[model samples]
Target chain A: MQTVQTIITDLKDKPGALLPILHAVQNSLGYVPPEIVPTIAKALNLSRAEVHGVISFYHYFRDHAPGKKTVRICRAESCLAMGGKALESQIKTKLGIDYHETTEDGNYSLEAVYCLGNCACSPAIQIDNDVYGRVTAESFNEILTEQSA
Target chain B: MSITVYVPCDSSAVSLGANRVANAITQEAEKRGVEINVVRNGSRGMYWLEPMVEVATDNGRIAYGAVKTGDVASLFDANFLNGGTHALNLGLTEEIPYLKKQQRLTFARVGITDPVSVEDYVAHDGYRGLKNALSYSQAEIVKHVSDSGLRGRGGAAFPTGIKWNTVLNTPSEQKYIICNADEGDSGTFSDRMIMEGDPLVLIEGMTIAGLAVGATQGYIYLRIEYPHALEILNAAIANATAANYLGENIQGSGKTFHLEVRQGAGAYVCGEETALMESLEGKRGLVRFKPPLPAISGLFGKPTVVNNVISLASVPVILDKGGEFYRDFGMGRSRGTLPLQLAGNLKHAGLVELAFGATLREVLYDFGGGSATGKPIRAVQVGGPLGSYLPESQFDTPLDYEAFAAIWAVLGHGGIVAFDETVDMAQMAKYSMEFCVEESCGKCTPCRIGSTRGYEVMDEIVNKRDLDKNIPLLRSLCDTMLNGSLCAMGGMTPYPVLSALNHFPEDFGIKAA
Candidate 1:
């Protein structure tokens, strides 16, 4: 992990650096640890409450370490209209963990996203950056296997 | 010479397979041993004819739409590069009736310009507003906005000038300008479209706001769902900063306006101004009590001017052409053009930025071309999930803030979602409550607990419970939520529920009293 000093020193002077730092950290180290909030707060001259508030407000910023592969199930209205609930349940059963939880083997992390804007192909899920549309419970296993390897 | 063809790859266009079509065009050109430049531009929001491909020639750009991968070989053979007519003929891209009819002030250069290139943005009247604004006093700029009659496009139609004026009056050493781009509504994708297609316009608009309000920093609270939009914006910001359009001494004017994009967690409540402010400050997106308006004490408790993406996006046009030019376009108090998002079961689901007072029938039948399934139009949910479901009879109602308010309806975000006869109003009404329950922040009592209870009451009434008592109970609960609750999320949740109860009484298996 990059030290807090390095992260702070790099980001502090740049205007609107907090969000960029959060995004960079999340991109580099799967999640933003709570321990680094104070370092960000002190560096940016913001209170820890303020820094912590922003981190928690967005669902994209995860505090906990994700599994090796992360799958974001679409829960947007269009997806929901097309049996996303059943699809979500099926993934949960297969993984043995609920939404926002990681599997025991550290192979999969499941979370819900509002929309991937792939409504035409309804029931979409993004396994990392690649979006798979018209996803089914049966196909999810195949997709997961592909990612796991 | 390399033959250049432009196709849309913005999310909406991509959803329709523009990339596949682009690849096919590239392959066909390659097979012919002809060099090609397939530049992926953004959509003009003529969505029905998506995967729209524009071929550049000496004559200008000619558009062909609904083009498939298989059609590429034929397209290339027809001398499309030389502007020869083909069976997939779309005439001139600008002359398309859907594109021609729209008064796209805020979304002016979206489809026509290259998104990533700063030089292309400048060629199409971009950053002219900031350049024009630098000459005027901040007060003069605020006065110009006051005359434009531009209102917040993010649900509440608050005047932008007054908000800027409030921030201007405040004696603060530091202030901030925040663009609320957390467009969480199911049917509204206009914000995402604007961000992807014309990111520089938004950057320019925010910079103008920053200059006017004496604020040095701006943040666009974009929803996390829009990864593509965020990527486009980040690159656009860096490009702008590199060109001295942003950062210290913008355009060498000695005025600084720096901006950044803040990705929001998938919380619906954060769309509210106060909740959005809380989220910006890095707090849980719970709505705060008013009295301290965001203009007086907002993000980081400094005087802040928070405006919607459309509201700020409209500013550049107002500044350049003068406010009266924009003020002249609309009818009544709802001045200037509105980028109405036509979605759901419509034949033409796209963006139409028209002046206020265009009748709903014109928007539905004329613009939307009726339902996609060729079924009878049952209801159109204007404004989003929280908006009321207007029945067929209300088609005569004009699209204006006052006219909508007359029927207890709001033209929220101008997202008109058409539903066919197949759509069950009861199910949709149930989903409204369910959505509120799912997305509710749980800070207030009526919204937090009431939405869950409302869902149960709705289920009971629809299933087996005594209809007479449950109906009244539902209305009473709606009233409680409308009167109570901190933000519009809970307060406006009852609009869809009540509208369905009033308009589609048959869906509930209850006879009108």
Candidate 2:
């Protein structure tokens, strides 16, 4: 666990420190803990509402805990054109959880992204940072297998 | 004291191994005990002969192209440092036909200077706009921008000057300026290129926006996918801040402004203004109702000006050269150059910032050189995936906002994705609705529920089950979604589906005998 001082001291004086601190905390602890809000508020000379408002402003900041493995599917226009919807439905059925919902076994957290800009090979998904393009429903099973293992 | 070597850092150049080529030159120069200044610059956007490098000479910058890491030794032997020519021709970097033909006002410094160097930016007349803007009243600045005929480059052609004017008119204790860099459009990398190639211009543009609107705080909503761009921008912001270009009492003007970058999780809907604002507030990517347009009550319910990266980035030039000078380059209501992103199956996939009146044929044939696969170009999808698929007959169409809208299409983000004859329009059509269903924020009924049903109905048409009923159903569904959705995610969802249904009915089994 990172001390509140470490997080605040690391970014307090910077010009655009809010998002970076939020990203840093999330990277270190998987989520931006509510505990840091007060610390960030004090360190940046902001109110808790101000800090929390900044935290909640961007979509990337997560407050809840994530499952062990993350599965992100590209549902952007190009991906959808290439059978992404069917693939998404198949994945949900296989995982038995809808988007933004964690699996019962804590194995996966599924979410959809707009465009990965990997449209050259349509119907793409990002398993962590690695992009898999032209992916089908059949290829999705292998992703779960890796997570299951 | 300075020995200059150019590193062509354009996206196409990177795709064609310019990074490796640049690295090799760096390492070889180190080995030979040559004191060299390596500057990574933006692409000239003439992509066919990419990996194009430039070396500064007494006469002018000399150009070299199609260079690889392996070609470094020959380049060294050819005495490139002293301006000797190799097989990769050289006359003057400025005189290249493709580059020379372009009336580059917005992209004047692109591919010419080091993106990270403030010295290079200043040498190329950077910050002149900000400097000029500093002397003007906020209202005067906004008036100048309004007169320039600048509109939002993200998608909708909202007048930029009007937006700034609104934020200025709104009597708020706290106002905001946000640069929407969530460039989620496929086949479009102008946002990436501009950030990587000329970051200071964007900074300058944003600063001008901040100054124009009496806002002390600003945020750049950047996408997470652009890690490299984020890094470059963060560095530039830091340098600017240290030099007092950003943050408290900028350049001792007694006026204050602070800017920060907010990295977005990969959400497509977040590109929408309200959704972007919501995401910036750290909620689920959901669209907000308009009327209290972002100009009135945006970004924490303060008077906010949300402009796209290109729109904000174009401000400096509009200020420095005068709005009239910047406005003179484009045709009609579209009064400025657009950073056209030519991508997908095209032979020349790169950034081309040209005037609005340029025809599709000129871009596809004259600039893009047709299909990369060497197959006959069948159709092109201008604007991102949400744009309608225009057949060859529409090739005569010019790429202006009104011109494109007149033809039942939109040049969203100026991304042109070319497809060869091999592409199936039916599958593509199905994918469009399917895409909307997947990315829809579920905030509105038309987008969330209608898109899913539209997909099913589209599938029914292609599968030839109750074909007549389903075709009309899909059309009606598209119509409802278009009118009802809060944002274009649901609104523009109809473009691909409707275009496919209209143009390729045979593919949907209507004419298939």
| Clash pairs, model 2 backbone | A56-B281, A56-B282, A57-B279, A57-B280, A57-B281, A57-B282, A58-B279, A58-B280, A58-B282, A81-B431
- Docking model 2 quality class: incorrect
Per-residue lDDT of model 1, residues B235-295, tens digit only: 9999999999999988889999889788777788888888888777656788989979999
- Sliding window of 10 residues with minimal summed lDDT for model 1 chain B: B9-18
lDDT of each: 0.84, 0.79
- Model 2 lDDT on a 0 to 1 scale: 0.79
Write one digit per residue (lDDT tens) for candidate 2, span B1-513. 657988776544664567788899989888888888888888777665678888888988888877878889888888888778799865688887667766676678888877777878899999999988999999888878988898899888799998898899898999999999999887677787788788889989988998898998889998886666777788888888888888888888887878888888666788899888887765567798888888999988899999888898899998997888877877889988888877666776666778889999998888778877788877788888789888888999998999999989998888887777776777778878887776788889999998899888878877889987887788889899999988899888899778877777777878733
A47-145: candidate 1 lDDT, tens digit per residue: 999888778756788887899878888765555545676898998999999987888998889988766655434567887766665578888888777
Off by over 4 Å in 2: A3-22, A29-149, B9-16
- Taking all chains together, each candidate's TM-score versus the true structure is 0.89, 0.84
- Candidate 1 at residue B150, lDDT? 91
How much does candidate 2 score in TM-score?
A: 0.84
The TM-scores of chain A alone, one per candidate, are: 0.92, 0.91
